[model samples]
Structure formats: structure tokens, C-alpha cells
Target chain A: MGKTIAEKILQSHLLDDGAVVEPGNIVRAWVDVALLNDVNGPIAFRHFANMGGGPVARPDKVVLVCDHFAPAPNAPGARLIGDMRRFAQEKGIEHFFDVGKGGIEHTLAPEQGLIVAGDLVAGGDSHTGTAGAFGAFGTGMSWAGMAAIMMLDETWFKVPESMRFELRGKKAPFVTGKDVILRVLGEIGVDGALYRSMEFGGPGVAELNIDERMAICNMMVEAGAKTGMVEPDAETEAYAKAHAKRAYTLVRADADAQYASRHDIDLAAMRPMVAKPYSPENVVAVDAAKGVHVDQVYMGNCANGTLTDLRQIASVLAGRKVARGTRAIIVPATQQVYVQAMKEGLIEQFIAAGAAVTTPTCGACFGGHNGALDDGEVAVATVNRNFKGRAGHAGAQVYLANSYVAAAAAVAGEIVDPAVL
Target chain B: MIFEGNIHVVGDHCDTDVMIPGRYLSLVEPCEIAKHIFEEVDPGFVKRVQPGDILVAGKNFGSGSGREHAPFGLKGLGLSCIVAASFSRTFYRMAIDLGLPILTCEAAARAAKVGQRARIDTASGEIRIDRQVFRTQPMPPFIQEIIEQGGLTAWVKAEVARRRASA
Candidate 1:
């Protein structure tokens, strides 16, 4: 049997057990990158304090960002940042990004060249799988797991069986990778492919640029897949060409590799989709989901805040005003994407439409920061989550959707079809 | 080491956010996270759970965001073991490394019911459910060490102390 890209990366970092490790196999492997944030950083700092020294390993490999509660919203949050800063300074970790410079941990990693193609990365955040967008095998761990990687440079991995997603025809206009993933969640239901690595292939997948593929793979967690990836191809080559420092080789899964299951999606058949309240897997087409009045519309996160996402939102919102009584909040994913959106005039269109443009942060997605809804409020957000109280008070509701739908919902003051708009 | 506990069965798709949502994420104290464990699904869980209870759930247990607090919360609540049909890969790795015994007994989903007495042997991967015997995937040596040291934080402290004494 031929190897998948995941298999090849695992082999490159395999430990001495010499076992062809499969999922649940106990195997130790090296970490290419390790990331932490304010939430887990303070605990790690306390552990480091008890250990009585700098990091047990080098600092260059570690990334510490204060995106969790940056700007120190309160006294306790401020003190958490203080602990993180002290830890970074003592460890000589130069990659530490303060409040303004740092965004979401996953968004900051790739833009900073920390997550390169073919690299195996680990973070303290579950969305570490977000790095898999670059064709790297990325996952998150606990503070203890991170500390071990900090000390021994190795952690165990159970090689997950692969699930293949083959995209066929082209996507319809106004539809995007976000729609494709929402459709996948609708088909598979959450936990459909548990503990498996869902791999993407096929001609339709190739049409998407790396950012688009990243958008799909980034939300795989919503479907309960541990990680999802597309086999890096020429589009991958072009993406790495600009961001990567050293030359890198693109990788693909072999033809005969084993897969737990396979799915074929025809992008042309898909319509803009939305995941209604309670769960992302609770999906429906835009037309099928009419009249779900939304009090707020948020269009940003590691999932849908790329330059592509902003441009698409702008395409529909341009020259139009946001509907009264609806608040549209636009947050770019990274500094680079923010600058690009500003340069392209997308930011101006968004603001002129009465949308509030905020700095890049993991806000609204986790309900932790800005735009959190009041009790009984309903939000149509392009973020990955929609569980009860996910955006605010327990009585609040969050509806997940693509940027187009979110933009349309903002303009219509309810969940509406972009095509209709 | 072995763990004995009351087992609670959560159905499929017990995600991490449901295990511990973002509102309580600000609380760094594990005890605080413990107060909200399963607040979404089991509103009375935090207040009702006793020490040394095992949480048994269906497939894809602990899916969603990568928050160590999820595991920390459970451990802090005196959750001794988590036996699921399988776990989301990230949570499985984190649980083991953090010294939480996250064992998987594929048959346990069908065999073990809530309020059942479950006994788990970490080294041998044997689980005794009432009178029935079930086998789980045995944790590796390194993970066993973390558990033995009572978790990663304690393990690092022990190592640090050992180094001081030797020096």
C-alpha cells in the first residue's frame, strides 16, 4: 500500500519502536512547533515555576501569544498576561506577541512561518488542527503534553485511519469551501468519522486555493473529525512559495492507501448553507433556512476571516447598507489579512455598510470577547460554533454560516440567501 | 495503578465546549471549571458528581476546541477515569499526558450503564464492569509514568527536585 501525506510525515518523525504506528499505537515523535496562549500559558508558567528554571528546552521552537484575553479586559486577565510575559522573558522566547500584534493563536502561527508544509506541529489549543491548512499534521495538547514536548521533544501519536473526501465538479458562484464543509457536516452528522484523519483529494478540491482549503479543513472539528486536510498540490506549491522561507515539496496520499471511509462531493450541486442553532451539524440550505431573524451578524474567525472571506463578503455588501436593528461585525483573521482587506477597499465597504470593523481576534467565536450577544439574542456568525450561549448569555443563540450568508443576513436583518440579495 | 468509580454514560458527540464552555474558560482554577463540568448536557452534574467517578461516553467523546481546562475540569471534579468508545485524537493525547486515565473500551458503550461500578486496571487495560470483564487499549509506558507521577506538572516537579538533589 502507498503512504498518505500523513503517513509520510509520521514516518519522518517516527521513534525507535519501529512499529508502523496506526491510531492508538503508542509511539513517540518529534514536534516541529509548539504554541501556547494566555489560558494555558499561566498553568504552564506555574509548572515551570515549580520546576525552578527556564524552559527545559530551547525557546526558539516555542511560540507564546496572548490572544486568549489580550488587552487584559480585567484585573485577573491582566495578571494572566503578566505571568505569560514573565514566562516568555525568562525562557528567552522571542516569538511572543503582545496584545496588538497577536491575534488568534492559529492565525498568527502560519502568517509567522511557524507552520510550514510537511511539518508536524502541536499547540495547546484544539484548533491547532488549524495548522493542518498548510498541509502540516497539527494537533493540540494539554499543558503537561506541551511541557513534555518542551523537555523531550517527543510525544506519542496514534496514527489515525484516513477518511477521504473527493470533491468533483466546481463550486457554484457565491458558494465557497465553507459551504462545502457545512454540507459535509450535514451529510456525516457530527462524529460521523470519529478519531479519523479526513483527507481531501480530487479535481474539485484542487480548484480551491490554500486559503480556501484551509477554510474547509479548519472546521473539520465541527464534524468531530480529529483533523482534516487536503493533499497539497500546485495550489499548495503557490501558497508556500510566498510564505515559506526554504524550498519545500508538496505531498499527496497514495492511490491504494487504506481509508476508513470515502465521500464524494459535487461542489456544483451545493448551495450556500447555514448551520442553525444548537449545532454546526444542524445544517440546511440557505433557502430552506428562511426567516431566522438574526440580531447580529459576525464575519470573522480562523475559519472564515481570510482575505478571500473578506473579499467575498465585500462583493455582496458593497454599495449597500446593513439592515436596521442588525449589527454586522467584521474581524479579519490576521494582521496580514487585515492589511490586505484594507488595501483592497473591502474594509471601507464593510464600514460604509454600517458594519463594525474590529481588530483581528478570536472574538465572538467563543463568546469570550466583543460582540457577545445578550440573553435571548440571536447571532448569525461565520464562526465554527453554534452551541447554546456560545456567543453570550445562556439564553442567547448562535447560528453558523458561510460569510456570504452572514453578510446577507446582516443586510436583510435575518438569515437570507446571498443569491436573493 | 487502578481506578474504581461510578460510571456515567454520555451519548455520542460529547464535545469539549459542552464539557466546558467558554464562559468558565476565564477561571484558571480547576475547581472552578469543575463547577461547570457538563453544565450544558447535565445541568446537575457539577453539583452531584462524587470523587472517583468515571465518565463513559459514546464515540467522539471530547471533540471540539483544544482547551486543557476540559481535562483539568474533569480531574478537578474528582473524575478518576474517562472510558469512551473512542476519543477525539487531541483530547486522548492530552488526557494521557496530563495524567488523566483516558481509557477506551469499545465494548464499554454497550456493556456499561450509568451508575454501574467500574474498576479499571491501567497497566493491564482490564476493566471489570459489575461481573463482566472488558479489555481496553492499554496506555503506553510514558503515559503510565505521567499517571504514576500524578500528572505532567507533578512529574516535572519531581524531575526538577531530583536534579537539585543530585547536583
Candidate 2:
């Protein structure tokens, strides 16, 4: 009869006094942080304007990130960013991260400590679940829902049942949170956790770093999950203390918390997993997909664009040259991460290895711009979601892998385990 | 609300990208975005769909991305309803906000055929397709109220007016 972490967080933020928090019960809740991006911001603002245009309830809590089409990919994209800039200035919204100031919202939000444990965060982007890595209850909402939040500082939710994932054992060499999540997706298929919170815990949770945790939670949406969370621990505390801008409470699931279903994942048993074209759930071990030729190898996105991921790629491409006929593009997730990578020499090393290191934008990952694939091109990327046309032309194929695997593909021009190199 | 129409069928995991490719996301007009819906998977979808047509699909419909354009485009195409085995949580909320009725009935989704005449009663959760009667959980009273008010925007407008009056 105990409550899950998600349940407890939602309970504390309930807007209706004395409202019960349980799965399938709709409850109004206040959010501590709300994110809007270029793609959703324009629409949300239009709705806000149509609702008789008033000052937002919490300008400080509202975050507008121009990431999806940062630097203005086209005329329309520029217009969208222009709208965001003008609105931010007029409304006095505090946390507007423009083109060069930020990268992806999910990465920048956490890096800037906009969110902390036990807070309820909502964003118009599906990857808002990425904040759950910090033990916060983060979920995606509609633009209209966000507009309503902007007006009232609150939204509604049908409390979702929690699916407990007990990760046990330390990960093997070259294995990462990306592989761990890919393996989980392979086990459950896409809709296995639909509308359910994926709560991670157990001994293996300690073995993964905060960046790894972010990578895992970022893709929970691909599995149709409502949100993804990890139990707060010492590792979480260290990262939060260094970056968190606000006070936070490390919320934990009760000892006897009820779970809709339970899955036990052995990290040691995990390998360099890859999701084939058109589906994140269609996964295969690296060995099974070895020697598959790739025309491009991209290393970036909220899922795998962390500093740790950059280091992993640098380790693989340290002195090697990218294979002939293969293009390697590496993107840092945020401005801070880009500067840190530059200070650490990852950028120079990437460029020296025949790869192109670019600024922190989600352009390539979402096929918005930067490095869209040519027709029939094949790519091995460290990004999540390999859906058709995800990275480029519909005829093109994308293979989702960890940074190590992606970097190895850049060197070998094929899908191969990094350990083999 | 009762909606009667012919159904356009799609399979499971029909993501937002396939529904409305990410490239067209910057196009704010719903009708403009609707011109490209399912262009990749079904190139003829835009040309074939009628104003009152319904969209029938398997589980995990609208799986990827949180773009409201997917529902906006569908609504622009004048879809009466979307009946599927299930809908991703984000898409479900967007549909509700846009006043687009969506029902979760595995039997109804599985039994539906392309171009088949189907009828749905949102209040009753009854789906009728070719003499088959499938029952689904009806929309909750609160959500029904939102739909009746023509979506969240109108509801918010009325609420804002009421609050000002009270103040």
C-alpha cells in the first residue's frame, strides 16, 4: 500500500486540497518548472495570446529554449525564434536560452539546475522525461496544456501506474546507459511501459553516473512511458549539490511501493545494443549488426550528448582517422558542454580524427538541419529514435547505438563493437 | 457527441514523425501541415482522406515527439474521431485539448476495416462497425466538459472571465 516515487511527488504538488493520488485518478497539480521550445513555444504563445493575453503566473518557472531550430534553420524557423525572443522580452520571462546560450532544453535544463529532485516539471517536448533522471516527476504536455499552465501555473494528470525496473550488477566494458535502455526496449517492446512511470533502482543504479542516468531516461518516451525516474542516492546528491539552483528534497519510493509490473535488468549481461531503422524497440546486439556499412556516424542529442558521451567518443577516435567515404559529425548538447569539451580538447581531437565538431544544437538529431542524411544513406548515431526519416530521407536508415559504438562505426565504416578495436 | 464516418486504417506505433514529418513542424497552419500527413508511409493519405473520415490504428498511436501538430493536422483534415487500441499519453491529452475525440477499444480497432462505415458515441463509448458493437470506457465527466466547451482554450477563456467577475 506504500506509494511510488512518482505518486509521492504528484501528491505533494496536488492543486486540489486533500485530493487522493492513485493510478487512473485525475488530479490537478502545480509544476515547479515548465519548458517550451521553438517548435511548441510559438503555438503555445498564440494560445496564450488568444486567451486574452495576461502576465504569466510564474515567469521564473517558465523556461523558453530555442533549440529545435536554433540559429534559424530557415525563414519560418527564424520567425518562430523571433516570436519567442519578443515574447520573452515583453513578458519578462527569466529563463529564455537563445541560440548560442543553450543547446537542447532537456540537457540545458538539468545542466543549469533548473530542475531538482522531487519537483514536478512539465514541458511541451516529449523528452521532458529526461528531467526524471534527477528523481523529479517530469512529463510532456500539449502546447495548449502548457498555455493553460502559463496562465494558471497548474495542470492536470491521470496518475500513472509505476513499472519498477530493478537494475542489478555493474555494466560491462563499453556498455552504457544507452545500451541498458536499448536492451530494456528490446525486452518490453515499444508500448510495454505505455502510460506508466519507469522507476529505476537496485544495486546497479549506483554504478551509472548522472549523465548515464540522463541518457536512460531521455528515451523512456520512445517506449511510450509517461515518465522515467531513478531513486535518489549519493551520486544524485553530488551532481545536484554542484549544479542545483533551488532547494530540493530527494524523494524515494516506499519500501513496499506497489508496482504494476517489475523487470529485473542485469547490467553485466548487457552489450553494445543497437536499434535498427524505423523502431527503437527493434534492437540487436552489436555483434549481430557488425560489419553493416554506414555512410555517417553522428554523436549527439539529449540522449547521448553529455560530457561523458563526448569522452567516450574521444576515447574511441583518439588517434584514428574516420574511414574514407564516411562522415563523422559530433555535437555537444549545450553551450556549457561545448565549452567544457573544448577545454578538455575533445573538439580538437574530433576534428583531428576527420570528424566535424559542431555547436550545441538538436539540428542533426531531429533532421532539422546541420547533417541530414542523403537518400538511401545509412548512419549509426548516438541519438534516440531511429524511426523512418528521423535523420533524413525516408529511404535512409539509422542505427541507434552508444557513443562508443557510434565512434567505432566512424572509424571502421561499419557497425562493430568498440572493444574489438 | 456521435460521429459517423469511414475509417482510414494504420498500424501500431504510428509515430508523430510519420503522422506529420518533423520537417513540416514549422508550418503553423493546421491545414498546411495536414497536406503532408502520412506522406512518407502512405503517400496518398492526404488525397484520399475525406473531411468526416475517422482514423483507426493499433496500439501506441502518436508514439514519438510531443508536437501538437499531429493532432492539429488531423483535426484540420476534419477527422470526426480517432479510434485506436491505445494512444500515447501526450497525444491523448493533445487530442482532448484540441477537442478531437479519441477512444481506446482494442476490439474496435482490430475489427475496423479501411473505408468501412463506423459510428462512435463519445458519451456512451459505443463503437459500431459493420454490425459489430465494441464497448470502450467512456470519457470522464471532466474531460467531457472540456470537449463540450470546445477544448481547453475556450474553457480557459470562460474561466478567465468568471475569475474577473468574481474579483
Candidate 3:
């Protein structure tokens, strides 16, 4: 039996006494990157202290980011940020990203070249799987698990079985990675890939860029997956060459790799998809949801806040003003992305079109701040999750869509396909 | 370890947001978080839930977010265990790491009713609900060890000391 890409990465990082890298076997493996954010950083720092705080095994590999509650939304949030700063300084952690320095941890880590192909990355945030976009094995863990990694530079995992998603054909115009993933979620339902690795490959993978790949991998968690990945290709190599700070080996699945199951997705047939309120799996075609009034339209998050997304959104909002009754919030995921959007004039177009463009922060996406919804409000956003109370008051509803569709909604004040706009 | 409690039933996809809304994530104290458990989805849940009550739910329980606060809050409220048809990987790991025992048994989860007394034997993977009996795969030795050691925090503490002493 040949090995899958996930198995190969995990096996390469296994400790001397680690178990075999097979499905259902628990193995302790070294981590290349251990990520933390303000929401979970303080707790993890406390655990690190409890475990006899000393110099971290790999300070450079450990990253602390403050985007969840950047700039401090309240006193408690401020305290969390303060604790992260103190710990970062005390430990001499080299990759501590404070507010105004970085954006969301997921988006920031990759842009800074902290992750590379074949690396095993763990973080305290669910969307940590976004690193899979770089052809690395990325998964989320508990704070205690993160603390253990911080101290010992290793963590345990029960190897997940692999599920292959073969992408074929080119995607339709205006259809982004968000639509592709929503379509997958609709097919698999929540838990369809429970505790399994979702591996993307085939010719269609070439059609989507890094941003689209990131968007696809980021939502693997929504399908209850352990991680999501794309096989390293020319585009991946180009990305790594441009940004990677360290050397990387492109790990690919063997020709006869074993997969628990496989699904074929034809990107050409893809269309604008929407996930109704309270569940990412509650999906429908845009036509089914057309004319559904929306009070707000938000574009940006770890899932869809890349430069690609900004360009897509800007293209839709180029000469259009936000509908009279609707408000739009556009957030660039990272400082670099924000600056790039500004240089490209995407930010200007957004603001000139009545959309509020904000700095790099995860505030509005996680309901931390910036633009939480009011009761009874309805929004169409590019965020990954639409669970109740995800973006604000419990009474508010959110629909998940690609950036193009979301921007179209901002201009129409209703759910409409970007193609028609 | 055997735990007996009345189960509080919830439907599928009981996400972390419903368990503890993102707004209250800033509250690190478990007790403070316990007060808001299921506050958004079921307003009276906190008031009605008693100590040692088990949570029975359908598929994909704790389906969203990697926040440990969800399981931490439940443990703080004295939840003895959680039995679900299935659990999201993140929540499942967080629960075990927090020393909160959970079991996945489709039959048991489906058969369970609100206010019914259920008993779970972690060692045997046996679940008794009312007059019905169900069996699930027992947790692996590593996970059992973590639970016995009272979560990863305590386990890591001892491991750190042991490694230092040996070194």
C-alpha cells in the first residue's frame, strides 16, 4: 500500500518512539509551526508556565498572533493582548505579530513564509487547516496540546484516513474557491469527511490559484475534516520559492496511494452557491435564494480575504454603489494584503462604492468587533461558518457565499448571482 | 470509570457558538462560561441543567470552532460526559484533552431521551439507557491515560518533571 501525502508528511516528522503513520494509529511527531492567537494564547501561555516554563524548544517555529481581538475590544480582550505581549517578550518568541503588524494568524503565517510544503503545522484556531493550501499538514488542537508542543516541540495525532477530491475541468468565471467548497460541503454534508484528510488533486487543481486553494482548504473543518490539502504543483513551487524562508521538500502521494474514498468535482459545472443561516451545509443555488433581502454584505475572512478575493470583489463593485438599504464591510486579511489592495486601488473602489474598507483584522468575521450584526439583520458574507450567533446577535442570520456573489449582494441588497450582475 | 446521569438531549450540529457564543470567549473562567452554555440556542438550558447531567445529541455535535471553552464550560457545569452519534474532530480532541469523557454510539444517541437516566462505563464502552444497553468502541489506551491523568495540562506537568529528573 502506497502512502498518501498526509501520511508521508506525518511519517517524516515522527519521533523515534512514535507509532506507525497509519490510519487510527496514534503517533507523536515534531511540528514545524505551532500557531497561537489572542483568544487561546493566554490560556496556552498559562499551561506552558505550569509545565515548567523554560526556553521554548523552537522559538522561531512558535508564532503568536493577535487578530481575534486586535486593538482590544474591551478590558478583558485588552488583558488577553497584554498577556500575549508579555509572554512573547519573556520567551523571546521571534514571530509575535501584534495589531497593525499582521492580520489573522492563518493568513499571516503563510504570507510571512512560516509554513512550507511537507511541514506539519498545528494551531489553536480551527481554521489552522488553512496551511494545507501550501501542501502542508495543518490541524487544530486544544490549548493544552499547543502548550505541550511549545515546550517539547512535538504533539500527538491519531492518523486520519485520507479522502481524495479529484478536481477536473476549469471553474466557471466569477465562481471562486468559496463556491467550490460550498458545493463540496453540500455533497458531503457536515461530518461527511469526519476525522479524515481531504486531498485535492487532478487537472482542475491548476485552475485555482493559491488564494482559491486557501479558501478551499480553510473550510475543510466545516466538513469535519482533520485537514485539507492540494498536491504540490508548479504553482505551489512558485509560491514556496517566492515566500518560503526555509528549504522545503514537495511531498506528493504515491501513484497507488490508498484512499478511504474518493469524489470527483467538475469545476466547470460549478455555480454560485449559498449556505443558509446557521449551517455551512445548508446550501442552495443562488437562484433558489435570489431576491432574499440582505441588510449587510461582508467580504473578507481567513477563508476569502486574500488579494484575489479583494480583486474579485473590487471588480464587482467597480462602478456600483452599495444598495441604498444595504451596508458593506470589506476587510483585507493581512497588512500586506491590505497594502496591496490599496496599491491596486481596490480599497479606493470599495470605499468610493459606499463599502467600508477596514484594516487587516478578523474582528467582524468572528463577531469580535468592527461590524457585528443587529438583531433581525441578515447578511451575506464570505466567512466560513454561519452557525447561530456567529456574526452577532442570535436573531441575526448569515448566508455564506463567494466574494463575487457577496459583493453583488452588496450592490443589489439581495442574494443574486454575480454572473447576472 | 462509571458515570451515571440524566441526559439533556440536543439535536444535530450543536456548534461551539451555541455552546458558548464568541462574545463570551473572553471569559476564561470556566464558571463564568458555564452560565452562558447554550444561552443563545436554548435560553433556559443553564438554569435547568443539573450537576452530573450527561449530554445526548445527534450527529456532528460541537461541529464548529476549535474553542476549548465549549467543553470547558460543560465540564465546569458538572457535565459528567457527552454521548453523541458523532463528534467533530476538534471538539472530540478538546473534550478528551480537557478530561471530559465522550462516547460515540449511534444507537445510544438515537435511543436516548431527555431526563432519562443513563450510565456509561468508560472502561467497557457500555452505555445503559433506561432498560436498553448499547456498546461503543472503548477509547484507546493513550486517551484513557490522559483522562486518568486529568487532562493534558496535568499530564504534561508530570511528563515535564519526569523528563527533567531523568535528564
Candidate 4:
């Protein structure tokens, strides 16, 4: 009879004329954030202008960030960013982050305190679900959806049913939030949580920090989940209060709340996991991937390039050089992460270890540039997807693993269990 | 809207990337992007999809990146509708916003075959394919309004006009 966190948020934001919405019901609900990046922002902005919709519904809530292909790789990318800047200025949109100020929108929103608990947020990137770690109902919207929200300040939802995940035990050593999510994807397959709210709860969730939880929720998109949520607790409060832009409210699913399915996971028995080439759903134990030679190992992306991930990799690669003939790339998620990692000497340690520490960019992870595989090359990456041609040439192979696994692969020049190190 | 066309069938998880690869994300013109729609799956797909043609697929069609271009391109190519058992949430919204009507009929999705002549009556919620007839739920009134107004953009324009007049 009770509501999930997603239901509560949608219920609160329902339009005045909107009927009460239950799971599977459809209604228009106000969203707190309308976020987009350079890649997709121009299209939505163009659509908005063409609609003759004057001014944004809420300029402050419209966050336009230039991360993907920012610092413009070529004329087209630059033109798009230029168009976005003009739109932001002409429309008086406040949170417009240009090059250097913002990195990935997923990481930037939380860092700037723009997103908080119990909020409904939408971004134009599939990985926008990353913000759900803060207990916000974060999701990615298509260009048309973005345009609608910009013009009307509200969007519609089907009130997705909830799927509850209960982590029962302390996780295994070297296991990560990425590994946990990979395990879930492997067990359930890609469409396991389609159109469902994946709500994380239970004793073992406390073991993960906000960033780690983000790493897990970010990949919920890979499994076709509409959103991933964690009930905001003390840790959530600390993270929110540290950089929160507005008032915060912790939301939880009631004990008697209905769920489509509930999964109880034993974290301690989990093993280091990797998603083999072609699909994030194609997962295997780290042992199964051992000694598989790799040409590159990339440890960055909205999924795993957080400050914690950088620290985890630094601790693994300290005083050791990258393996011969292997390229190691470390990308911080944001300027703040870059600065913090530099201050913590993690960047120095990585550079000293022969790893290339690039600026915060989603480029390499999405196979844009800065780092990409050529034909016949293989890589072990910390990015979420390893779909064909996702990171490089269609003939190139990409394997997805956690930061520790990626770092170990860099050192060993091959995929392997970090526990063996 | 009632439409009759040949069905171009695809299987589950027909991702947006395959529909319109990211390599063409920079192309703002929907028709330009439409030229490459389904370039990977069937290189001649764009050449064959006539105006008002229909696409039918299994579960989880449009399952990749949130480019929004794929649906827009499909619409620009004059695709009348997409009927599938299910659609990725983002893609479903995109299809709706692009004025591309989508009906979810499991019976049609499973029974419809490629190259079959199909007719959809959105108002009647009937899907007729060759000799098979499948029933689907009509779009809710709110969704119908958006479709009638020609996608989200035109709907917003009309709403803005009405609001200004009232004010």
C-alpha cells in the first residue's frame, strides 16, 4: 500500500489537475533539473527555439553542460557548443557550465550541489541515472523529452514498478560497486529491470560510499532500468549537506511497499567481475579473464572515474610502472576530482607510474578521442559498456572491469584478478 | 491516424545506436540523419522504408544511448509508427515527442513477420496484418493530443499561444 521513493517524488510533483498515480499509471510530474550536454543540448535547444517557446520554464533548473566533445575537437563540435552557449545566454539559463568548469554532467551536478535527495532529475545522457545515489529520481530524457521539460517544466512518467535489492553481507576484498552491479547484470541479463525503479536497501548498502553507490546506479541504465535509488541515510545526508544547493529531504520506501521483485545478494561471496566484449550483460568472474592480454587499460568514465576510484587505482599502482607495450589512461571525473586527486598525490603517483593522466573528459570512455583502440587492439576498461565499436574500431575488443581490475591489468598488461597481485 | 504499410521487423533490443549511429550525431537535420537509419542492420533499409511505413519489433527496441536522433530521424523518414511489445523508456518518450505513434501489442509483435502488409487504426486500437488481427490499447487522450498537435514542439507552441491569449 505504501509508495516507493520514485512514487513519492512523482506524487509530490504531480500537476494540479493530474490524477493520483500508482505504479503503471501515467501522469505529468515536475522535474527539478533539466540537464543536457553539448552533444545533445544543441538539438533540444534548437527544438525549443523552433517551438517558439519563449524563455525556459525555469532557467535555474535548466542545466546545460559542455562535456562530451567539449574544448571542441573540430568545427562541428565547437559550433554545437557555441550554439549552446548562445542559447544559455539568450535564455538567461543559470547553471550553464562551459569548458574547464564542468566535466561530465553526471558528476558535475552532484559536485555543484544542484541535485539533492527526494528530487526528480533528468539529463540527456543515458548514464544520468548516476545521480540516483543521492536518493534523487534521476533519469535520462530524449531530446524531445528535454525540449518538453524545458518548455513546460514538467515531463510525464509511467510510474515504474519498483525492484528492491537487498545486499545482505559485507563484500569480498577488492570487490567494488562496479563488480556488484556487474554481478546483478549477469544474473538478471540486460533487460532484467526494464521500466522499473531499482531501489537499493539493506545492511550491506552501508558499506558503500555515495560514489560507490553512484558507480552501481550509473550502470542501471545498462540493465535497462529506468532509475536506481538508495534510501537517503546518514551518509547521504553528509554528502548532501556538504555541497547541497537547496533543502534536502530523505525519502524511503515503506517496509510494506510493493515491489515487482526483490533480490537478496550476499556481498561477501561476490567475486571480481568483468563484462566481456560486445555486451555489459556478458559478465564473468575475474578468474575467467586472467592472463587475457590487453593493449590498453582505461580507468575513467562517469561510472568508475570518481575520486575514490582514482585513489583505489593509485594504491594499486604505487611506485610501479605500467607494463611494457601497454597504455594506461587515468581520467578524473571532474575538475574537482582532478584537483583533489592531485592534492592527494594520486595523480602524481599515476604519472610517475607511466600512466597518462588526462583532463576530465567523457571522450575516451565514449571512444571520442584522447584514448581509443585501433583495429585488433583490446582494452580492459572501467567504463560501463563494452558494446561493439563503443570504445574504438568495431574490430577492437573492449572488456569492462572495476578500477582495481583495470589498474591490475595495466600493470600486468593483461586482464586478471587483482587478488593475485 | 490510420496508416497502412509493410512491416520491417526486428528482434529484441534493437538499440538506437544501430538505428542511427553516433557517428552522425552532429548532423542536425533529421532527414540527413534518417539517411543512415538502420545502416548497419540493413544497408538498404533507408532506401526501402516508404513514407508512412511501419516498424514492428520485439521487446526492448530502441535500447541504447539517449541520442534522441534515432526517433527523430525515423520520423523524418516518414515512419508512421512503431509497434513493439515494449520499448526502452527513453526511446518511447522520443518516439512520442517526434510525433511517431507507437502501439504496444504483444500479439502483433510476436505474430507479425517482415514484409507483411500491415494496417493500424490508432483510433480503433486494431492492428490488421495480412490475415491476422490483433487488438491494442488506444493512446491515452493526453498522448493523443500531443500526437495530433504534431509532436511535443508543436504542442508546446500551441499551448504557449493559448496561454498568452488567456493572459
Best by TM-score: 2
Worst 10 residues of 2 chain B by lDDT: B17-26
Q: Tell me how much of the true interface, by contacts, candidate 4 captures.
A: 0.59
The CAPRI quality class of candidate 3 comes to: medium
Error of 2 at A243 (Å): 1.1
The runs of at least 3 residues in candidate 4 whose Cα sits more than 4 Å from the true structure, single-residue gaps closed, are: none
Off by over 4 Å in 3: none
Tens-digit lDDT track of model 4 for A321-387: 8999999999898899999998999988998999999887787677677787888999999988776
Candidate order (lDDT): 2, 3, 4, 1
Model 1: fraction of the reference interface contacts it also forms: 0.61
Judged by DockQ cut-offs, the docking class of candidate 1 is: medium
Judge candidate 1 at residue A272 and give its lDDT: 88
lDDT of 3 by residue, B1-167 (tens): 79999989998888998889888878888899999999877889888888889999999999889998999999999999999999999999888988999999999999999999999999899999999999999888889989988788888888878888999
For candidate 2, lDDT tens digit of each residue in A258-355?
A: 99999999998888999998899999999999989999999999767899999999999998999998999998999999999999999999999999
Which runs of model 2 end up more than 4 angstroms from their true locations? none
* Colliding residue pairs in candidate 4: none
Indicate which candidate wins on lDDT: 2
Error of 3 at A9 (Å): 0.6
Highest DockQ scorer:
2
Question: Which ranges of candidate 1 are over 4 A from the true structure?
Answer: A15-24, A50-53, B40-43, B110-116, B126-135, B140-142, B154-167
Score candidate 4 by TM-score against the native: 0.96
Question: lDDT by residue for model 1 over B21-66, one digit each (tens)?
Answer: 7866778888887888878667998876789998888887877777
> Scored by CA lDDT, what does every candidate get?
0.79, 0.91, 0.90, 0.86
